[model samples]
Structure formats: structure tokens, C-alpha cells
Target: MTAPVAKLLLKVFTYRQLAVGGGFLAGFGYVYCGIGFALSALPGYIILEDHFQDQFPKALSASSLFNFIGIAVLPPLLQYLKTLFGSREAFILFGAVTWHMIPAGFGLRDAVPRGGCIDRPSVSKRHAKTKRDLKFVNKYLSFCSCLFYHKNYAILVVTEFLSSLIYISWALFLVSLGTSAGLREESAVILSTAAGVGSFLGTALAIGLFHFQKMNAYTSCAVPLLVNGIGLVGLTFARDFNSLLSLTLLTGFCLGVNISGMIGIIPSLVCRYHFQQAVVINYFIDGIAYQFGGLISGAIRDLYGSTLYVYGFAALLSFVALPWILIWACNKDPNRECEPDLS
Candidate 1:
């Protein structure tokens, strides 16, 4: 919906109306992001759960590795494009290339079986009309109700929110923090690149640990949180580029592990049919948390005039959350039968 509309606006508008076009693009971008999150994560996890059930963690790690590569490349690639062409032309070119996704979307197939995670069948016209009438009232209410139905899922949602808050805050401030620590802008950017490399390495390491070492889901999740907390503390004392880069790498590695564990463990925590809903809810909260986290971190940086304080605050929060995760893992129901390979 938003994608096509954004594409159309980009195609029709000229550089003179760039501001108007950008406004339309920003307005629709959030919707597109939300939709993309659901589509990419839910279906991919469902398909992996259905087929590669035993190797879900490895699969998730591999997927995250690829995603990290893209994230690491996109910024520099866009900058290069902006340099080669002016900002207006670069944006136009980007929009034109991205429009290819519409055609590419046609290749997607429903990997889930009929009556699986999501079931939608053709209904009678009358029934469809009736649903439309009630949708306005029921839609948000039902979504809100889902948040409280499952205790484990609710815990995961909280964990995701906090984790996203910390992770995004750190990511958004990493370069600034590096510069504050006496590095040049180019060096700070290089540190960010090092973080990306660390993320790739972390995912690869998680894959190995999950596959060969037989690390359980709980340990996989909790260890990364602990590692990240420690890394954040380390960052508070990092005074030079080398030290900052090392701390950034450590944080990035733990971030990769945490992300993979979160996605990989979902199938183990809930039944197949509920997996998609759980992920959708978790990511929705995560998105909100990320936005607020950035804002809050910015505020903290402004108030304190120090990224160290922000890092310390995030570390403190991480440590505070650690015990709950440990307790949850300790109390996990042994008889639960969502996924046999969770161990």
C-alpha cells in the first residue's frame, strides 16, 4: 500500500518538489517498515521452524550475517551514490531501483501449509463485508489482548524492548562517541565498520556454538546480554580509538548473538501457530522502544555532555534485566513440547 504510493510520488515528483515528496515518503516509510518487519521475520521463521527445525539457530545466525552485510554496506553505498549524482538524482535513482521490489514480491510463495501459522481462505462477499464493519473496533482491541495471553511471550516482548532500546541507542551514538573519544570522523566511521565486521563474526560464532557445542537457547540468549553489558562498561573507560573500536566490536558481537538468539528461540518458546503473532508483537514493541531509546539517549547526551553516562546507564539496565532472564530460563517448563531441539 505505502510502497506503491511512495513509488508513485517519487516517480511523478521533480527535484523542485523534493521536500513535498520527502514528506510523503517519510509519512509512508513507517508503515512500510512495520509491514516489512512482519513479512520478513514471521514467514521466514515459520518456514525455518517447519523445515529446518533442529538447525533453527544456525539458520537464524546465517540470515543475520547476511542482513548485517547489507546494513554494513548500505550507508557507504548511499553516500557514494550521493557523491556520484547529486542528492536529488541519487534519491530518484534509489527510488527507481527500489521499485523493482514490487515485481520481485511476486516470486514469494506461501511456505506454510494451509491452516498453518496463518490461515486466510476466500470468504463470501457478505461475510467479508461484515468483517470490514467490525474491523475498525476489533483490530486494535484484539492486538492489545494478545500481549497478555502468554507469560513467556510477554517476557520475551519485554526483553526485546529493552534490548532494542539499548542496542539502537548505542548504534545511533557510536560514531559520536568515537569522535568524543578523540578519533577523527573517518576513524569513527572505521570503528563502525569494525562493529559490522564484529557482528558478522559473532553470528558465525553463534552458528558454530549452537551447532557443534550444543548450547541451549537460554544460555544463548542470556550470555549475549551479559556480554553486551560488560562491553558497555568497558566502553565507559575507552579513551583511544583502539580501545573504543575493541569495545564497539565486543558490543556488536553480543548484539549479533542476542538478535539471533531472540529470533531462533521463538519456535522453542511457542507453538507453531502462535509463532508469527508472537514475533509481530515483539517487533512492534521493539520498534517503539528503538525510537524512544534514540530520543532518550540523545537527551541524556545533551544533558550530561558525555556518551559515557549513556553507556553506563544502558549497562546498568542490562545488568538489571539479566537476573530475570536467568530466572526464567531456570524455571522453564521441561515438559513443554514446542520444539524438541531447544537444548
Candidate 2:
């Protein structure tokens, strides 16, 4: 009787998690899908960039913005959505895809100029069962990585750990570079714009080049990190701040390409359909990445007393990320199929 009761408790715990995690994922996925749906418009990013800048006092630090992303924004968004539409993750996913395609179709037809307002179609029903529909069409956004299981996910996650470290280090270095080079605040703003443009173009190129390639996600990620490392190294030799900014444009753009490519690895890199759990696992690792990156970058900046050396240090650390990149990008994991949740 005790054995049976213990098993019963274990089963209850699992079901409880299914209720909570699944519900959390659903609400979060919904808002995310809604945002994605609207952003399918090409002009959406520019509009957002401007809108965000308009809300601030002027050129607040990027770190501060990230703090907002972590603290104020993401938590509330997750909670509110979970409450408002917890049971309706599938519907949210559908709405997101619909919004994405509708705007895209209009753009193709030249029916509306990019960014023109099209009325949003209303949600026709709201009598949702208030529970996660795990089998909902949201699987289209599921992580489907071949590497995420077996030993490969371990390898790839390790590689991302190192690479993300260097990636963030470079971002931190840029502010110091701007101030030390005596570039006006306005010039720094312009440099950011240039970097954004370059990043967008680079990602576009990756998409075009890898359009038909298998495991393009992995290849796409590796190519950009290699390029970004090279670019950051070159930044050390930049003659002036403007020159530094110019060099950084190349690096930033290359990084932009890799960022999405890295994210695209989620399901394929994780072992199963539990992609959200896998990704949340990464978020845990990434916390250390940010904390340590900032601590080390700041420590070196103070010790070396040179922006050039600080940049060089960041570039060198990027090398540690290389082994992971080489292995994951080059190796084929035999494309194992994920077993469905049978229960």
C-alpha cells in the first residue's frame, strides 16, 4: 500500500508540472507569437527601434535596457499572458501565424505599403477550457533539433556558453570604446544604427545562402561567430573612435546573423519535444555568462587602462567558443526522431 501511494504521489507531481509548465509555455508562446505576427512586416523593427528610443531619456545604457528585459518586462509579460490566455496557447499560436502571413500577403500583393495598418481580425471564441492543449498546432514552433539529445546537445550548449560569453563581452566593450575615443554621444548613436543595418543585412545574406541547405541552422551559426571573432580582433587596430565604430559595424552585423541562427538550434539541439525546458536550462547558463562577462570585462578594462587591450581580451576569449562551434557545425548527429509523448 505504501509503494502504491508513493507511485501515486510521483504521478501527481508529474501531472502538476504538466499543468504549470505547459500553461506557462502556452501563455508565453502566445504573446511571443503575437509579437512575431506583427513583426512580419519589414518596417516593424524600425518602428520599434524608434518607439523604444522615444520612451527613454536619451541613449540610456544598453545594460540598463537588458535589466529591464530581465526584471520588469519579461516576468510581467509571462505572468499576465499566462493568466489571460493560459488555456489558449494554440489559439495564440494560430493568431500569430495568421498575423504574420496576412501582413506578408499584403506586402506581396502591394495591397498596402509596408507598415500600413490592416485591421486585426478578432478572436472569434474565448470559451477556452483554461488548460494547456499540449497537442495544439503550436508544434510548428517546437524545437526539432537533431543534436539536442544524445551527447551533441551537451557539446553545442558548451559551445554556445563560450561564444555567448565573448559575444556579450564585445557589446560591453563598445560603450567604453565610445567614451575613450571621445566620440560624441550622437556619434555613438549613429554607430549603433550602422551596426543594426549591418546586422540585418548579414542575417539576410545567411537566409539567402542557406535557403536549401540541411542543418543550415548549425552552419549559419558557426559562420558568423568565426567572422565576428575576426572582426573584433580587427577592431583593436582602428585608428579613431569612428574607425572603431566602423569596424564594430562589421562585427555587430556578423553577430546579428549568428544570434537567430543560434536560437534556431533549440529543438534540433535539444533531445526532445521538451524544448522549452531545454531553453530555460540555457537561460540558467546564460545568467552566469552575463555575470561573469561583465565582471571580467570590467576588471580587465580597469587593469589594462586601454580600450584596445580590453577589446583584444574579448576577441581572444571568443576563441574558447571555437571548439564547440567546429564540432557541432561539422558533425552530423544521424538525425534521430523524437518519440512522441505517449501518455
Best by lDDT: 1
After aligning candidate 2 to the native by TM-score, how far in Å is the CA of 123 from where it should be? 40
Off by over 4 Å in 1: 1-41, 86-104, 112-150, 335-343
TM-scores, each model vs. reference: 0.74, 0.53
Would you list the C-alpha lDDT of every candidate in the order shown? 0.70, 0.54
Itemize residue pairs with steric clashes in candidate 1: none
Instruction: List model 2 lDDT by residue over 24-127, tens digit each.
Output: 76668655754553345333322332344332111112212232233223323444565677837744643453554665545543222234332333211211
Model 1 lDDT tens row, 149-190: 345655666777888888887777777888888987666776
What is the Cα-based lDDT of residue 134 in candidate 2? Answer: 31
- For each candidate in turn, give its C-alpha RMSD to the true structure in angstroms: 9.5, 18.3
lDDT of 2 at 119: 31
Q: What lDDT score goes with residue 313 in model 2?
A: 76
